[model samples]
Target chain A: MSLRLQARKLACERDDRWLFRGLDLDIRAGEIVRVEGPNGSGKTTLLKILSGQLADYHGELFWNEAPMRRSRKAFLANLLYLGHSPGVKAALTPLENLAWYQALAGEPDDAAARLEALASVGLVGFEEVPAGQLSAGQQRRVALARLTLIPRPLWVLDEPFTAIDRDGVVALEARLSAHARQGGCVLVTTHHALAASSALRRIRLGQGGDDAGA
Target chain B: MPGPDASPVSEQQAGVACREPREGTAVAVRATLKRDLVLMLRRRSEVLNPLVFFALVITLFPIGISPDPALLASIAPGLLWVAALLAALLSLDSLFRSDFEDGSLEQLLLSPQPLPALVLAKVAVHWLLTGLPLALMAPVLGIMLSLPAGSYAVLALSLALGSASLSLIGAIGAALIVGLSRGGVLLSLLVLPLYIPVLIFGAGAVQAAILGAGVAAHLAILGALLAVALMFAPWAIAASLRISING
Candidate 1:
């Protein structure tokens, strides 16, 4: 199974300001690509564009050698994106959140699977507790549990480590590396460094090094 | 790197790939509908607020205008219709606010399923909780307003049909303004204008019934409006939601 994501001459403007221009990237399976930049440097914006969320841009994106627009459904089906927010409902428990999320992703509903996912994320006793009562880190964990439930080829994560503690960060890094080893690709933007022993690539936005040649 | 044995990749893939049934648009709609209902149920106040507002507004009309049955009866149809329209509008601001704030809206946008189907589901739940209840409650309020004897049934039926269009059209405005911090007033401004046609026909149906005129034409127009909304409003709402979230 071979998969590739390529972007050419991408440019984006926000609020009459040029966030980035002439950016290009290529990602392949079994590789981890990290987007590095300072605040207001368009790291999150670029991630959103790659994930097909933000469209106000000038660029061409190809997934597996096909235009992203022409094959959006297939591309999206093969992609999993986790944005800066945890995206868990406060009124729902972790298990319920996972169930709805899986259903949205077109995954089969499995109560036992959801329970096990929550447990794997160290949310054992809190499975039934509403997410509103969970701490910031615990809520983030609830969202992260999705990584275990589905095995999409590409993951675009924005600030996945925002509220995570040291242990959570280490565990998440291991998961990223493992995913890469399993022939999946990951695109992540975070201030914290990932301790993954894999073929890591970096694209530093806003600097001259906007293009990370594969 | 973690050893292959320690990695959950194989187990996770097996779990994900070995499912019996794959979800589709129908599943997406059901999931969104169920989740929204559960959220609204927990915050029962949201479901009840518009109904109470509809009742309160109806109650004030008789006292403010005049308590005489003739005076109240003459104006009851328009009064009830207008009050219900405003009440439904009041609840529109909340349709997307919580979801947007909690970041679940982003998830919905990113879902592989068609956004229009999911949006239709959300609006369906809104109608069920707010619009349908208001329609059911109109008869009780109709008696209080001293509406003509034969018009009570027409009032309830008109509202049931008219509110469906209201929910659909109002959802577009709600989606457009969801990103703004103070969108309550702007939402009304955007939606109320579009509500004119619905109001004219909805009130007309009851008026015709009271006057002993044929109510068929008004009811037909209202149903036609709802059909048009059901066909087009979902797409508009989905597009507006995208703009609000991406902009």
Candidate 2:
């Protein structure tokens, strides 16, 4: 069940500007890697590349000693990605959002478990309310509920802490650490410093003097 | 926290074994179709806007051009088809916009299910809500336009078949420009050219039926176009989506 993700000499350019070049990363089972970078430093772009969502970059990625492209389905099935947006449909309720997430992940129907997961996220009374009516943080919480609902080995989360309060951050850190303790790997990008006891690896982008003018 | 070596191999394998039996392709398709339908259902205006636009556009042509029944009936076949095509186009911009805005499109892209199958599901829902309704409502608009009596059924039938192809083909254009901020005009520009064949055959079906000729040929051609679009449009749409998102 051992899993490894490795990238070599990755490079990306956007709008005639070099965001990052000569970037490399490696992650194994039971690890949490945080990508740190300044604004416009391509942190989200890097995460997208790692998740196979973006292909314009120049790089080679290997998963479990095989080319990532060779077994995309197998790789994606074991991966969970949460982008900057909460991905909640405003027209839908929290329960419906979680249900759709579960279904898309190929998980079986379990209404009882979904309700418990929503409740654990502090959405007890807001399950049936339209997400458009919820606060920004509450909508973010609705997206965070997926952490407890699905059990994928690799998680590529982009700013999972945005709009979340202090207590929410603490609970989320605990959840990430728990995932690592269970031999799962997470590749996350967030501005907020994680307060987990587990060892955290860091990848800093745009360190060189690449942006001199404008 | 436990180190990497703390978990026993047997327990870890058990966890892997637990998640192996995923839902099949059919289930995945049904889930996507159901999710989109449910979301669109909640936003009732999205479904009704195009239908209303179709009826309004049909109603305007008579008052705008002339009240003469002979002129209206003579042009009704082309007018109805054109109006229906424009109505379908009205909804195409939104087929992927809301999902892309809310980030659900990224989830759909990341899903392990076949991309083409999932995209086909989305197009199916679009046609079901927009294209199918416009087809069913065409006869009423036809009556308003004084369409020849013999061609009423053919008008609806041709629209039902033709709009399926329109939705499928229009989806490709929609997917291509979904990332752009001002894609409405460009969507029409890209899709309208491809719609010519469907338009000719669809109106031709009604025209042939009005003249008491064998309309089977025109209807068959429309069906064939749908069959071809069904086979190939999904892949084109899936590719266009990838390009749009990755850009």
Candidate 3:
């Protein structure tokens, strides 16, 4: 299987403020790499860099050995990154939101199936209602609905469990575990420990030493 | 539902699965335009605000400044064009703000389609909402201004080209300032100066028509500005959006 993510000497900065420097990491197929760190530790920045959202960072990030900086669309097409914000438009119905997302992700005709995915995420009766009217957890679930499609090979989740209820968190863990079991990779940053049976590895950032251990 | 032909069934299902990743440019552009148009239509207020602003500004001149038919007729073209520009700028702040706030902008950035194409779709919808309506309403306002019968053609033509350019160029400012909260007023301040050339040519075309110098030169300039913006604004807007979004 191809290497899912490979970062070499990755460095990131914002507003002349150095966030991370000379960091290297890798995740292979069927792997779950959790990035643990305190707030302002640049976890989200690192995820954005790895996911090909920020290109000004130093060093190299490769998805399937292709430089992520050069061809982001191919890289992004193979991965899904859920940031802190759920990213759903409030005025658009859940189905409409998913349908637009599918099209933007280049999956226009998949609205019917996308609606099914939305339903699986507990957005059943509210499928046609604008996402803004839904509760916070429901909106997050609307974003999570994209995971059920499974077209992408890698999932980079930043604080996915934020605002999720206890049951929802368990369901998410199971989904992540199943994704890894199916030879997919997941790079996630979360405050809570994810309990799963998969071969999980943790990378704790922002420590005094180079403390990279599984 | 299982049967001896389950293998074929599974193969067909694989071929026709939902949630599959999309992978083309033209298809993506079409889909994006459709989505944007639908959103613009549903949010009727956003579409009408600029038009109303145009009419209000046009009406304000006759009430606050002067109702003298001679003066209104002479200044109508300039007032109408200027008002339309301001009105368009008024609505441009929402071009990306709502999307950026709701995370839809990030999804658009993640799309496999080129960012410029997505930006074009957005600009197109903006033109439909803000620019197109103002263009249609120019003649009505022209009559109010007592615009010479001969200059009405030039007035309408200049507005069409001029507002299209305004939408395109305003999109650049909108994308740049979207990262900042309360970007609406600041966006106008930033984009208004940039619209000087369009406003110049747009109003000049009408003035020339009344002066019997032929409106061709001004119309051509307005068209040229529109072309220049069409060529460059998308790339600029897309790049700016990426910077603000990732920052």
Candidate 4:
């Protein structure tokens, strides 16, 4: 549980409008940071920049005190990002989808638990079914299945509660708390309130303050 | 299937499975290749369409032009090369489309593995399913075109080598426009110009062989083009993917 990520003077302007400017932020392990803002407030853009997916913004990002630009591979190695879209292949079954992601993770040992992870997400017999045929909630569960199977230290989740059910929401909240407690961290953006008990920090955008949450 | 005792995954089992020693690039490449092959094979119709297009277009040339054997023979090299090139382009749109749509492309960009290596795997799968089949299928079309007696093997050889370069070049355009919902026309506009060198050399190989000249120089140049593409296209593809996704 140490200072894991830091951003300095991060500013993003899209279409001649400033989303956030002169923003400084620090994130440590064993913490859950929630990014909240009105729609078009650059919440998703911020998460994408942190995850190294979008590079159109102006900022400095650091992972473990090293500039992310220099250690991008290291940053990506420790990161897992789940966007609004579930990233599930329609042609691949749930098991197959998880299996392909497992390959990208580059760890072959924990693959045996993929079925159990799907089951935990309430996708019991749907393991062999094509993800496209599943409901949107089920498809989100397929992407969420990675939370259990892939053991990354940092997670950047965008609207993770969308299309998910009540039981799923509770289970995901519990997972997030457990992860924070285990020296891992998460930076999540959602309209739905998270019930994770402690270590929850809220950072509201459009206010021009990086530590607006604390 | 999970046994009855499978519980919600224990986050505290930190000692269990986080030893992520970077597996070699070859391992990532194999996994990507196998994943794409399985996906392309399951969508069998998409895989078959390009070869079918090649045959149908070759069949139309005789009806559209002339049925005279001598006339067809004189133009067969260009005819076969153009048709095969179009078939390869027809299938190129899918090279990164589905993955881009599904957000798998984002996952790929974030993989700790080399992006170029993984992209090369995907392009290799494209050639295996589309280009290789088109090359194998060209000789049959060569017969339909009344291609000269000894030039059949040369036609196949040239196409097989030439189409590898085609897949590589076409992939660059596919990557650039993958973000567009309707990139088919834009892709052709971007890729067709780059395809000219391959078209010239590919048709020239068969033409040289048909003319009873040394086909070695033409084939060597095609191989050289493939080598250059193999060296650089993946990096371009990876960069373009980032751009498309970011934009």
Better of 1 and 2 by TM-score: 1
lDDT by residue for model 1 (A14-122), tens: 8777777778888888788999888988889999899888888998988878898986787777788888888999998898888889889898778997987787678
Tens digit of per-residue lDDT, candidate 4, span A108-197: 835568987797788998999988899999999999999878888888999999999887887788778767776788899999988756
Q: Provide fnat values for all models in the order shown.
A: 0.37, 0.35, 0.37, 0.39
Candidate 2 lDDT over residue span A6-105, tens digit each: 8887888888877887777778878889888898888899899999999998879887778989967778878889999989999999998888888888
Under CAPRI classification, how is model 1 graded? acceptable
Cα lDDT listed for each candidate: 0.86, 0.86, 0.79, 0.86
lDDT of 4 by residue, B115-140 (tens): 99999999999999998999899999
Clashes of each: 0, 0, 2, 1
- List per-model TM-scores for chain B: 0.94, 0.92, 0.90, 0.93
Return the lDDT, model 2, position A58: 83
Per-candidate TM-score against the hidden true structure: 0.95, 0.94, 0.91, 0.95
User: What shift in Å separates residue B115 of candidate 2 from its native position after superposition?
Assistant: 1.1
What DockQ does each candidate score versus the true complex, computed on alpha carbons? 0.47, 0.38, 0.33, 0.44
Ten contiguous residues minimizing lDDT sum, candidate 4 chain B: B1-10
The CAPRI quality class of candidate 3 comes to acceptable
Model 2, backbone clash pairs (residues 3+ apart or across chains), number: 0
Clashes of 3: 2
Model 1: chain A TM-score against the true structure: 0.95
TM-score for chain B in model 4: 0.93
Off by over 4 Å in 2: A196-198, A208-214, B1-23
In model 4, what is the error at residue B214, expressed in angstroms? 1.0
